[model samples]
Target: MKKFTSIKLAIAAACLAASSAQADTILGLYAGAQYWQVEPEGQFGSSDDQQAAFNYDDDAQGSFYVALEHPVPLIPNIKIRQTQLEVAGSQNMSFNFNGTAFDGKVSTEADLSNTDLTLYYEVLDNGLASLDFGVTVKSLDGEIMVMDDDGTSEMQELTGYVPMGYLAAQVGLPLTGLSLYGDVSVLSIGDHSLTDYQAGIAYAFVDNIAVDISAQLGYRSFKLELDDLDGIHSDLEFSGAYAGLEVHF
Candidate 1:
């Protein structure tokens, strides 16, 4: 079993390397990575009517994406992007969370960590501009543990998947190595609403026939509001600045 698995992995790696070693052309590949310094705010509760004031120190988030483009007509190019979200803080409550009642004087730490996976396609690509559209599935797979100074504790598990609309666009600046780009993934369905957006500028540093490398700086914001889904209800917002690197293969 181990030998078979290793053989499969080696084959996959060889194929990826062979494709990436070629020069950029009608069929090209690319990958990107970025990190953000996020500031989070707002409150969360077990029920919609019960919320606690929430605050946290600055947190860091990381994102990555890889894409494949081919000359096939009517078939969209595919890209996959993933991002990590994590935060921890202590706040006094306005009501109850995880069945622990508080009169606005109890101090407890809360951790809400999540990840978003986006699978999108290139709707339009050209020399002047490009656009992509698809769907993103946000996996809210984390937990919140609350405890007072007396060691009294409670745990509320947060786990769910939300499908959202994804769209992105990029515009090149004439007579320069700079470009502007923006991305959004949002939706309002049933009792939940989620929105994530980012806008940034990119500067190509090394562009040649074989490879291209670029630097990027941007700002991003995300909001998640839930209403009694999986016994969790809250409004959370994260906004911050980011820096990134992009490579064409």
Candidate 2:
């Protein structure tokens, strides 16, 4: 999704306050990256009854995030995340896209992804429990392209941004160095509904005040339902397991 913006002053104030009162509380900086092997299945066209089939083989997608959290109360913490959604497959499709009909055996590619800049408030963050809620602007800067083996090609550029609601929660097991975490972002309005979420277990190899390293394994699922916006109509789902590394400093 192409993302959303314009509410930076509140977060800027939080950062400023955190900088001024550095030694009184915790100021956490963290980064994480993951690789997901996705299986895609969906349909695309101008309308529901006039769509074409999509069956994609297994493929890998990359996602990463950087976040900053301080002792500030009301103003939200900041997390910047980038995810790539790319998958390709071959099929015999006959459908109408953007009001034009194309019929043939073609190779299709769907690239739907964006960088999410999120501002969230910590609802609860203690030793054993943590929860966060906020909003993000997902910048969709990708496209969908289809080509027949006979040199005929067509592409639909997906370039837009939308605001999504965000939620995250974590619960740690005592003395186990293990935790359960889930994160979600969703937007549903009018004729569009999009959602992405991940739930996983994380084991901390090294947990300390100054630095922490963790290994995480999780399942991620993303679904997109778009209705004739910008000439492309699509219903897509991409999901799979992921292994990731996260570090906090």
Candidate 3:
């Protein structure tokens, strides 16, 4: 009778451990917000030769994301992110912006705010590292307004959807609440291309049984090269440092 009771108790313990492990992989939610201080570079116009250079100063922008993960077989996780970016500058040059000719001192304002929807699968998620790869569809809905000294202005609309490839990876230090991570999305089709990437270090300040909070500092760069996708032909870039907080549950 003693031998039979010991066997039953061991089986129950094993079942309990298995149940706990399965629960850990069932669901997860992550949310984060970032503040980016970026410096603008490059020019915009109807062509490479007739472009107006931007005299932009450093600007601050905001971005945020929410992601949901599940362990369901054959199903991928989803993340939605929104980014805010805009800059204004003045230059004394001759340029043709979308068939409108501008001379003398002209002020230009460009807004490049966009939203991203990503569907990814977690390929590897061990204790020390993780990797995720998938597809991202970015929606850009902004405009460019240029005004000359005569108060005449031209508005060029920038509205389009771009598809890109996404990949992310992270490496964690054992017994330390620190990690290094990077992610990127890229696309190149014909004469137009877009690339956005970030590399950063994160430290977990709060580690709980059901939640984790982390602070991340990193560098982010975004480059956009277009061939009249929205009646605007331009090459532009915004690159700089960013800081953010993340919460995972």
Give me the candidate number with maximum lDDT.
3
Query: How many clashing residue pairs are found in candidate 3?
Result: 0
lDDT of 3: 0.91
Q: Which candidate number maximizes TM-score?
A: 3
Residue-wise C-alpha lDDT for candidate 3, range 155-202, written one tens digit per residue: 988998999999999999888899999999999999899999999999
**Residue range with the least summed lDDT across 10 consecutive positions in model 1:** 104-113
Off by over 4 Å in 2: 1-24
The segments of candidate 3 whose C-alpha lies over 4 angstroms from its true place after superposition are 1-22
Candidate order, TM-score descending: 3, 2, 1
lDDT of 1 by residue, 15-54 (tens): 8766654434467888999998999888778877777765
lDDT of 2 by residue, 165-207 (tens): 9999999999899999999999999889889899999999997
lDDT of 3 at 176: 89
Could you tell which candidate, 1 or 2, scores higher by TM-score? 2
| lDDT (CA) per prediction | 0.79, 0.85, 0.91
